[model samples]
Target: MNLKSAWSRRSFLSSLGVASGSLLTSATAKAEGMFGKKPKAETKRLVDGNPIVPITSGLGSTGDIYAELGVKPLINIVGTVTVIGGSVMKPEVMELIRRGNEHFVLIDELEVAAGKFIARLCKSPAGYTGLVTGGAAAAMVVGYAAMMTEDLEERIKLCPDVATFPRNEVIIQKAHRYAFDHQIRQTGAKLVEVVTREEMIAAINPKTVAIHFTNIQSDRGQVSGPETVAIAKAHGIYTFNDASADVPPVSRLWEYPAVGFDMVTFSGGKDIQGPQASGILIGKEELIHWALLNMSPQEDRIGRCCKVGKETIFGLLKALEIFVNQDYDETLRMYDARAKLISDAIAKFGVTARPREFNPNALGNVTPRYSWQIDPTKLKITGQDVMQGLADTKPVGIGSFGAGAGGMRGRDPEAEARMKAHPELAQQRRRGNGPGRDPNTFGFAVWQLKDGEDQIIADRLVEIFSAAPKA
Candidate 1:
């Protein structure tokens, strides 16, 4: 079936399930009354129609658990971001996760089976397979550990202390170094920084385990992917590509490994809409085997903390299956429709909302975005003001307006202190108030918004503009 049909069916089934649960409750109450016993008091439920599993009581529910705790849930306009919670799981994926919880199985056998399934689905190069990880970062720790330790139990136990190991160095481009490198560093391997192809070649020595390529920054570095692969191949060194956020062309899932990166990692939670804590690592069979040995269901290893549950593995597999087969053109159209709805609603307020064309080669979280240009002459409020206004909306806050303006709502004194201590961090705030950071403009992608959220956003925008004074 087409993606549109599949999505419609999934939504219908989800609604049917909720309706069935409600009907069951009503019938039970009626039966109790018919038997002449007083019907039990109706218990309040968490908003969003899903009762918290294991069902706790005494929680008043005008909203979801977030609201119960005085935190506002948001209409996510941001692409998959871990801070606000990654993309929602497809109904089928959630069903698989729930099903997986019903029976216990040997995690080792499950991982191997899942790996074979992933390898076949993604079309990884021969001698390569897949492994579910805690997250993309966990994949790095285990992938690097696999290269450094191989299959030796003695070496595995002594990981992160590879001071005496023959291969403890990872080569990376100077420009490619980012926050996620901490994962590589966690394995106790020293990162050898190289700026040029010649420098990379010269830096490789007896200790070099692999060349770490940051996929999104492939163009920024002097050495290209093919060149890096060639260099690694020539030297008999391993290569790993951190392509976590790179998908949507879905073909990239196998393409990178096909290009000779011995290991490649992707965030299952991001575009795949799998469990938030899950990731996929596909690479050489030998390396993946070593990675698995170092991770969960094993003891006293460097990756012991990075455990992947059976449910998460199943959910990620289902998500991957859906993601690969789903239609993208239809998805884009749905996003466009959502943007147009919000745009039309606020047009009278002099805000022009135009959709940005999707770039096929966008580095990560690829999605079409909508840019809202506020006509200063028609509306006194700036785009940042509108963002904040949306964030302050009642019932649910519409968010993902780039950090301080709205994305992070609560006060964070610790973060403020860190910013104060590290003045350069001020420059790191996303899309700061400078060029292209027009005060009269703000934008976000609509693909992440749930059903009917676009209308809520439209109604909220109307409320915000209605309250703003005319210019």
Candidate 2:
């Protein structure tokens, strides 16, 4: 549209009342102004006197990828676990990765640059440094190799096959033994499990390389962090704490190591919201240096297969930057709001849903938790039925019943027998959600619900209850 043609159309529209008289007049003035016959209206500015423009938008959607693959993405009410692909990374983290894709840098050089930033972010002590690895498990391999040797050449060569090495034992509290202990053992180190501090002290023979602790299991173990670190320090052994899933009061990243542990590993993907495949291992500078020697980029080392790409490192770095400084109180309030929404939604139907405080053992989804006491008589549906319905729905919503309600009960001999036959049963038990232990009580996490997802969940629940009970 030329200005004259535009004005003629506007004038015709104005005569037919399709355009307002003022609009026609404004169009005529714009036409005259374009020809320099009239003064143009001053261009408007935003409050800050800057030109208003739409901010940049649109990265391609993963939904398309999943759709093309004939797979549906599940709603993550179960929290950030490896099976569910961990929590989604922050926009800042993604942006860092987006920009990272545009360039190429030597892996070793990039690690050095990224390491400094991560060290500062994790508040690593002046003598300590940090390295982003392939998730918390990979950190185990790196940390194990680091503690295995101070000699760079020996460190790289001895890993992935430490049969000839003298100090090949990594002491761990029997209670702290977890699925990821395999990551540590992968470096040809044997895990020596001890129950008591006395046992741990006694177990730390000349062959002991380091002591490992699982942060979530810390509360259960008799040996406190300080005690473990003290024993390790006294014995001249390195201590590595697997503080993987325990985050959200993100201060724990540096706090654990600051308390005297030689190394601490945290999942970059979980609460820290980095790349799902990356993690942070921050501790003593010397140990981190040795670990870097044993990591990827040096294809001959034990952790060579634990390759963390340039994008993942940068993503973890950015996530750490935002995580530490983020307004956690505001986040908690949002979580609280989501929890309340679900609790409130179910309350009207005689179901008792309450927002529960976050328990450290809840792992990845550590925001406010919501548990429901559904009276089967009132709703005419069992908690198990509700769980199954939600699970069967398109874009499945997974939730847990009362803690330990789902999964193999330790006390049940049959459950134990079943666990041995199906090793995955053990994983499901640890996941905190399996078969409901109670028919009347069930719960779900709220923090993992994306915007407007709570409504979908609530509607789904209402729909399930609305249908008549099966005879």
- Cα lDDT tens digits, model 2, 100-193, are 6646779888887888888777787778888889988999888888777665586478676777677889999988888889888888899988
For each of the candidates, give the backbone clash count: 0, 2
lDDT of each: 0.87, 0.76
List where candidate 1 sits over 4 angstroms from the true fold.
Answer: 1-63, 400-431
The lDDT, on a scale of 0 to 1, for candidate 1 is 0.87
Question: What TM-score do all the candidates reach, one by one?
Answer: 0.84, 0.77
Error of 2 at 235 (Å): 1.6
- For model 1, residues 26-64, the per-residue Cα lDDT tens digits are 999999999999999877432243322332345543325
- What's every prediction's RMSD, in angstroms? 9.6, 11.5
Clashing pairs in 2: 405-437, 407-435
Q: Which residues of candidate 2, in runs, are more than 4 Å off?
A: 1-63, 360-365, 395-437, 468-471
Give the range of the ten consecutive residues with the poorest summed lDDT in model 1: 1-10
